[model samples]
Target chain A: MERRAVFKSRWLPYALIAPQVLLVFTFFYWPTGAALVWAFTLEQPWGGGSAFVGFDNFAAVFGDPLYWASVGRSVFFAASATTLAMGVALLLALFTDRQLSGYRAYRFVTIWPYAVAAPAAGLAFRFIFASEAGILAFLNQISPGLWNPSMNGNQAMLTIVVCYSWKYVSYNFIFLLAGLQAIPRALVEAGAMDGAGVLRRMRDIQLPLLQPTFFFLLVINLTESFVDSFGIVDIMTGGGPAKATNLMVYKIYFDGFKGLDYSGAAAQSIVLMVLVMALTFVQFRFIERRVHYR
Target chain B: MLYRERMGRAARIALLAACGLVGTVAADAQTRTKFDLWQGLSGDLGERVNDVCKRFNESQTEFEIVCTSQGSYDAAVQNAIAAYRAKKQPTIVQVFDAGTLDLMLSGAFVPARQLMEENGYKVDWANYFPGISNYYATSKGVLLSFPFNSSTAMFYWNKDAFAKIGETAAPKTWEDVEVAAKKMKAAGMECPLAIDFDTWQWMEQFHAIHNLPIATRDNGYSGLDAELTINKTKFVDFVKYLKRAHVEGWAKIKTRATGATLGEAFASGDCQMTQFSIAGHGTIVKTSKPGMNWDVAMMPVYAGTERHNSLVGGASLWVLQGKSKDEYRGAAAFLAFIAKPESEEYWSTVTGYIPVTKTGFAAMQAKGFYDKPTYKGRELAIQSLTASEVGPLTRGVRLGGFLQIRKEVTDALEAIFSDKMTVEQGLAQAVERSNATLRRFEKTYAGKTLP
Candidate 1:
């Protein structure tokens, strides 16, 4: 049965949600509006002046090769990090769902990492995977000059991707575990009575039922991997070693804030916002068709 | 009835005392001309800046400065710019070296010389060190801000490690450093030298001391029409040399990506030598391993290159516009106070930043401050800063959009060092990008000439 709370007055529901409505308008809509305006305008760093140059900022941004490179890196990072994090989380959730020994402890331990902040996680992983005098130092001893991320572009990209996935794995696990538990036990028991092995039961029943959850996590992971990786990228690579990790978000910050090219930065941000939106739309339009929602 | 009357009397007495306290607070606020000083340092350095304000407040009674830290240099400049837009700016803000040119062209400051003169302070503008002061000065040598927390790069080397390679002192030339690094490498040393990726040390300092122009038109001091000439210069050769050194297994990069800082690496005795700021002396003293013997020398140039003055690296105090006359007086007084010889000595003793004036250095020398083991080798920074007369090209860069330009150069270094691009290709592409930034900057402030 669908439940609904009836309001006594027309203004009651509006009053109840006014705070949230105000928050969204203030923090989200206002900034997005301002960025839209600033995208077509040139702002002086020291104030006192501005000029509107329609689409000049956008044209400059689109013409920049470095900007395009950052865009490509961002897309690659988004797909790689999302798949890696979600895959690891699904594996963890499956093992724990099997009711192994100390499953409760494993569940509790898994959620602890989600509490660790992104920058803190970035710093922790930065030291652990450090090329020299760190936990991975023994690799360099085996083959001298083999493990330095500072000099290697691909390795630098891998370092940030791994650190990004490590933080997000814990987050994805909690949701996947809940989705797995939401399934009816009787269906799985019937499949087991029919002599279906564990893997077969999961593939035929559990995974098919987990589609809605999978779609939900996919949207969040993909969208979040676009913008939320700023802290990790900043702390880990600062978009460096030849700008390998210079994602679009970090570039917007570096250009807009540090470089004080507010117009250029605002334009880059517009491009990033459009990219995230297009990604979400594509996922819903294409990927959601095959998702069987119960 | 009697108890109620007594309570009323007691309340009246308490209210009278509160009124009296408020009166005194109002009077104190009115008598002193209060102004805000937004500094861009924190932690130990921030404490020292606050302590300087405290000393100034104690030294006089006419005015008060409310000191606050914006946490970092970039934040301070950003906040100040934003505040200026809102017409809520502080009277005095600490702007970093890179921001000097940007602030200069913004036309938002009262020239330091004119402010002092109008405030009745007898400032010998020539007393400021040429190397330190020129960065914040106009094309004709008029200061636009007061040099605060000045420092320059020096070659830091481990004497103990160099002893293992039979070299007793720091290298004075690129050739000497190469020989020492190769010998250290031959002696089974894992990492002989570590260089960070900051363009300040590797590019600006390298070019400044070798009497080379980083850009045209006296590095943008003359006008706004200057373009980057870095690619056509010897920097390509320099990058190639560094690349070769890295390939030959003698030089190791100790940047943030490496999970170690250049200072920490040298301090921990892992890297034998590095070129970093003299201000890093404080960190080296605190973080160096036990019983490690190390010293610093002026950054080495090529063997045949005649040494010129290296540019300043830290920050300076810019008196922002739109402040009242009374606040200007207070700012001038504080500037004069910090410019004192004794104040310079105290500041350097506590913060490892070398004094920015010749008289300050002389006073420290006369007081035998440099004779102490803790303070030894710091005077070399002052010597390096004043190695020769300030030439047209050696007066420090005054280009617009310098922060972005520096990033381009660093990106070039990264690309070249990572083998993603050849030296000429990387530097040429960087120059092209940097020139575009300059063009945009020039367009932003169209028709405005350099001050």
Candidate 2:
């Protein structure tokens, strides 16, 4: 009799959620399943037909050195960008949370990059870093041979990391700020009364409290860096000076669209999906327990 | 509360009925005479295409051609494929040379010859420039696509930069180009010679200019069975020369893949000389600032071999299958209208593309269109194209998966130039990889073959 009453109480809420559940199944689940099937087949050249190739595509991708190189590049770029973005965002959040004068304006200015479209932001960075007529080139001219991002691989990577971090810092900052705000002021005051210095308080009280937000931000940042860097690379170096900038997504695009190696592209995409999912699962399983939400 | 609730229910019922009627009407209207057309030309080229469509629409009463610009040539092809899969494909599309094989094997295009003949349009297949037309035509000498916006590679030099370097004449040969580069370097120019899309200009056209094969089986035009011929000494020598230039700092590799527009770079005084498509003349003229003197010249030639001509680098209008007869008629009419001598002359004059017909060229000459100083060396581009030795190699390569093979070649070139691999090793690897791609493409499109 008690269970029946509980079920009746939740019935309307479950009915209200049914539409969203159906949509997710149809759009997300269906397409993802289709993509998995497609990864194993060869699309007919004339269209509307496909043939199963059993592991041939996967074997081809693994055997090709170019595919592996692109995977390596993708991981390198994602790791670097995520770490840099988190570091910058955390610092900015700490600074802005201090309640200093004009901090509102500073916060607004810092978040401006988030407003720019990814491709547009990428284009602006490209213009700034162009080899001959770009702003960096102009600066080099004035300085009589300054370090150029256009010519050097390390410099180019650094430039891309900086641009990516600039765009996402605001996103991370919002989360970190909310996390900071959620921490009880009483706890911070209690720590100070116990002779805990600012660093010590941050290390013990603030960091642990902010763990959940940081965890969430880390996953989001990793996915963004992995999947969304293609637009930046496309608009910026176009995977060039010589392919020093060709990330995994860019490689998939090149193979599928430009190269017409649909099978190879599909294989690479499957690998990318596997890698990202593995990382996401690891985070959820291993790190979620340590995250202090309250 | 009862009266108000009753009124709201009635209003909701009326609104739902009206919305349902409107949706049905809109769906019906969408199904009528809607022809989808895709083109790669964005910016100015796209604007001109739109204008032409507008005029065609005004001139016609039965067909409405909806032309959409899909960014670049490669993107346009990809869009068409996606659309085909969705069963919402365009009736006519502008596909570039690299996509020729992909479209041909797709078996989805109604060859232009058949389309026109079935629609009762008077199309003289013989009138087209044989060298240019044959590149996209079927094996039985049937036109597969309407030749539109055809262009050949040409030399572009900054006259002011050359003058500063004390060179009054254009470099006539590859040897002269090297010497001029040295002179420009001595004169403090940053880049004396920079070619855009290095693989296309340096390797493909270099092979074409020397009448050397880029691939076997008559460069894939004979059949789907083809293999890379980069192992040839001519190709090796060309790569050697390119490496020498790179080492000497006379030639700087562009950082971008689409490459820095050679014409724009020259106009900006960042580059002294470049070899690019003649079609870029319009943009170069428009974008050149005050006191930036520039001129066109013939592409530099190798010293020993015959100065073979370059192939066209522009898009062709292909008629797709599954369109209504009326729509096919409209497409044929539009193609014929554009190919007419007077219309061709106007198009060539407006957009720096070479006329596809001898009559069009004659008409332009009759009007003294070539007399303009701005068009001084453009005739050389056309003349060079005419004299091009359409040998087995220079004719133009076609294969089941030429697009993918081209990417492989590009990848190999990138690896070579980046010092990731040697030129010899790169060529060998490109051949091995490209052959595998060709085999796969062949298997996928097995039953389809040129008649």
iRMSD per prediction, in order? 1.6, 3.6
In candidate 2, what are the lDDT values of residues B1-451, reduced to their tens digit? Answer: 2344465467559868986877865454444465777999876677577667766665656666778889779888888888877777788999998888878877788888888888888777888877688788766456789989889888888888778878888888888889989988887888888754446666677777777788788778777877788766488866767778877889876544223566667666678788878888877777777778888887777776677767767889988877677777778877877887877876777788888987888888888888886666677777767666456666677866666666667667766765678989988887898888888776656666754
Which pairs of residues collide in model 1? Answer: none
Please give, for residues B1-451, the per-residue lDDT of candidate 1 as tens digits.
2354465467559868886877865565567889999999976788789889979987888999988889789899999998998899999999998777778878888999889999999988888999988888889988889999999999999999898977777898888988999999999997888986799999988889998889999999998888998888777778777888899989998976676889989999999999999999988988899999999999988988899999888999999999999999999999999999999999999998999888989999999999998889999999999999999988899887888899888888888887889999999998999999988887777767888
Q: Candidate 1: lDDT over CA atoms?
A: 0.88
Lowest summed lDDT across 10 adjacent residues in model 1 chain A is found at A42-51
Docking level for model 1: medium
lDDT of each: 0.88, 0.77
Deviation (Å) of B96 in candidate 1? 1.3
DockQ of each: 0.49, 0.29
